[model samples]
Target: MLNKDTLLRIGCFLREQTGKVAVYGLKLNAQAVYWHFPKSIACFLDRDINSGFFCGLPIRRIEDLPRNNIHAIVIAASLSAESHIYARICDFCDSHGIVIYSLYSGKLKAECLGKAFPAEENQESELRKAIASHDIVSFDIFDTLLMRKVLFPTDVFDIVEKRLREHGIDIPGFKNYRIQAERGDKRHKGLAGIYLTLAEMLGWTDSQAALVMREELAAERQVLVPRPGMGEILSYAHDIGKYVLLVSDMYLQPEFLQEVLAENQLTAYDELYVSDDRGTGKGEQLFELVRKEHPAETYLHIGDNAIMDGWSARVHGFDSWLVPSALQILKTTEAANILSFAENFNDRLLIGLFANRTFGNPFAVREKLVSVKSLPQFASFFLAPLAAQYVLWLLQRAKIHHFEGVLFAARDGWLFNRLYQAAAEIMKLPNVPPGMYFYGSRKLCISAALQEEKALEWLKGHLVGQTHHFLRECFGFLPGDGHIPPAWGEDTDLIWNEVVDKKESIFARSAVIKDGYERYVARLGLKREGRYAFADLCSQGTTQCALTHSVLPNLYGLFFARYMSGSSVTMGRVETFLPQADWHMLANNALEFIFSSPEPSAASVDENGNIIFEEEDRSDKELKLLDEAQEAIEKFCHEFFSLCESDGFISPAIGHFLLSMYQQPIFAGAGKVFDGMDINDNLMGVRVDCLLTNEK
Candidate 1:
């Protein structure tokens, strides 16, 4: 909405002006008359009797108007009737001794009148002001602003004749082809069409003719230059706070044109409007941009072609000045007429032209801040961190260690229990203590016996047994599975026989194991006498419980891994998932590290009070170890980051990894004892390993 001050200024100008003004015919023309004139001095006159609704003022016959006291009359007709009314008014004014003044005349007394009319209003007053204010005004770059120059207009005819003479076809009226080609070339529609006509005249094939035309046109385009005064005009526009807008019909690359503009030093336009970059023709796009960026300012559009720029402006409601070269005036008159006609017509013509045209909606203007609708629509950015935190909370409540949903596991207890028992027996040997054993289960513990020198040998033996058990129970295989029988041989069968069948002797030998087994069975409510009791307890406690717990620890591990990954993916996700938490942690950690350091000595201070900080140096050994540890941490973190970045089974993978990290024997050594440890000795090996491996 325009301010009342603008309206009042416009109204004052209308009251003060005394002239026969020719207003292009339009719906708003009559209203503009009211905007410009006092009610007492204004009169509405039109030849069409039915225009009363639009005129607002009472219709008066033009012929019946008294000649006295009417020194000047403004032609407030529709654009379609502008020329017709202008001619009529000019003749009438000349005969009646009245002076005829164009609406665009600079002699108009009111400078503030132009200020009142907004450029976006697309009124004649605004166009005049823009033209008067700016020295250079640019139009469409392609057809309107430039044309292909012909090297030899008459040569087109000569070539056709030469080709015909070679063919020896002395057909009557053969010279007519040359005449037509020359005429077409003069219009500068490009030589391709003319060449096609020449091909027809010479009776050549389409391909042969097209090849010749393409070659010629390509050569011609290399020497292309700006139209006369175009560069100077652009500089002038920039000097006077105007701009050179290259609103083209064809899609032109911005980079190429930008280079051109830069080379010419004509890039200082307050703004540039390019159709290819901005999306479409200058009609609605120009008006929409003007409304957003240059509201209330004046603008002038100068162009050679009329259809692309001239009519586009008139129909779409932007003020346009058509400056067709003197030679092009006859060809552009029809376009000028169309523009004039569109001013009086309703929005129907504009709508029809824009229909099926792929362009951004003119009404969808850019706003400074988010809209109320967007506040809810884009709430995901704000709520994602909260959602992740809630997920973490749920995971903690569940007390789940690992989640292995993506990997396949047998549902039966008997099969899984056999596997667990086999792994446990292998781990319980002299060298492989219960603490050293690690199976893919929570409750079962494996051990082995070997000298310190045979640690690797003992590990190989344990791996063989574990692999055999996995094949038989988890995969439901028999002894003939090649690697299984050979690796297990007789030792595994003997251990299985003694441990599983002779349970009483086994329990007497290891009371801790017996107690753990009993407690596990009790927890699962398995009947002691039943054959399936042990299997049920093992499957329920190790497989089911371990699988459930996998979720929590795995998720935690993934979070930590991503934090250490150093990849942008983790950082980005963390930004979304825990924006405030991440920022707070980073800020706090950096502050603590910075402030905790010793302050620089006074001797190191510069005259400006700036501290000349000394760089901390580290030994090669320390640096090497730090680099290695950082690399390992980075690698470990990358795996988690990769999982989070993917959409496939991400939650399950994260849960499992976290669970494994927390529950693994490697971490257990740090005094963070978990469930299922019977005595303090069970944790000795883990603690020793952590102490040896600790880098800090």
Candidate 2:
């Protein structure tokens, strides 16, 4: 809220007070004044002004302020607004030859600030001098200079047990003690106590037990790996002229600790403290030793165990830090107490860093890494897809083959035969050709041959006695004479030339046939395919016999075509006519004959000439006739418009047809017309059109 003028005035005032000054806006009022100051005035602003009120100065209004030679306006706003106000003040003071002093809590002392201070150059020089000074600083090794519990208890116990057994020191109860020791249960007693207990149980002499214990202890100690970054911190401290020391309540000898540190590439400390060497646990005595060793320098000790290291340091008047393992620290009930203690005690700070078993260092779990907790989370992860691709590549490298295909029934009975017959008819259709057809149940019969005849024969044999005999039998018609239309004779060879063989290309061909059929039906302007080549095309195999009967007139053309071809496609021979033969009788008789029915007229024909009263009337006669005609019209228009829309296929006559079809409610009215026709015909034209045009 501070304006440019107000900030400039505040900066000028600060410059008068101190040759080089920094202004801090502690609240909203302070920020308002700080922003209007000149660039020469360094202004620091608090982020959250509403939380509290400002009581420092009365430089609120920018207009009434005088422009003086103020050097800085340190906007000491609340922590929240510090960055924002600092940026604004710095930018406003940029061109005025002003140096803005931005106070950062992360780097600056929270409790100390003064108007007159050493120059920036002097501060930098002092910092360098501090770094160059050599001083011995003692640090507790466990949970301080080194990590705690590097190896699992089981791992350490295993090594100890193996060594003890090799030394011929056997005891039945040793295993239980090892288990308890590995778990770090102080209540279970220390390893030294366990070795004595085992020696007593095994009736061994003190000298023999001690000898075996030493060997097992050596083996166990070898497994205690140091924490990551501990050595680095120690080395860094040592490089800065700080003498390093390890103080722990460990039972290992000083020599062993030194060897371990040297192996881990750590600098040798000035002194080392182990319970065995110190003759006591960590306490005031340890601090007394450090004080005696380094009398002239300030010393700080850091460790994980609060009672042993922290309390001792406090009692001895030494600066201390508590750095605990992430897991153990989380489990501790005294975390709040430790944090409160750190807050109240200026010299101590409790630092928490995460460490896992495999990765010993405290590395941040990035937001991106943490996000991969669920399947969808993994899927959306930026690198997950790439990882999956890599895995797939690996699988390929391993030469892992897999099966990919569709499953279908392959029975050679009624339904199977019908399926085959349908497939065969589809293949036999002009411009239709054979391609891959899969058939089987859970246990499938696979064939990759291109010969339609061979495929059909294989299907028939494989499905003949199968549970899905009916389905297999139906599919069997794909290869044989039964599948072929009557127009194509048994001896007539399949013409495989010039037909596009790709499955997709074949499907496209079917779409073209379907389009042509629909357009031809539409041109006739009939509500149904009552009398067109389309109806016949719709009624080919036995599966479509009932369908053909529904659209009687359309099937007439197909029937005629088949009959004329003399291809021996079977239909019931109808030699006898009814006593009273008429248009209705002839139609009913033809349907009955085709279906192999003992009697026609099992259902009645309605006034609209539709067979509307029989459950057995699956034939789409009326609906097919009407819908086919409507669809044909729709196709003609769609094609005509498409052609017109294209660059070279424009025809006014076609356009007129398209316009006429578009205007006439053929699509909307077709539904009504279909409802009036037979149930079989209800969707025949639309379905056929969809099939032909590949609309579906």
Clashes of each: 37, 86
Listed in order, each prediction's TM-score against the native is 0.22, 0.31
Q: Give the TM-score of candidate 2.
A: 0.31
- Which stretches of candidate 2 lie above 4 Å from their native place? 1-134, 148-155, 162-198, 206-215, 329-359, 363-696
lDDT by residue (tens digit), candidate 2, 2-93? 43443454554455554534345555554554344433333232433323333333333221122434444454454345435544554445
Please give the RMSD to the true structure for each candidate, in Å.
Answer: 30.8, 30.6
Q: Which number leads on TM-score? A: 2
Give the lDDT of residue 434 in candidate 2: 18
Residue-level lDDT of model 1, residues 66-99, one tens digit each, is 4434454554443345435545555555555543
Give the CA lDDT, 0 to 100, for residue 359 in model 1.
Answer: 11
Model 1 Cα displacement at 437 (Å)?
Answer: 99
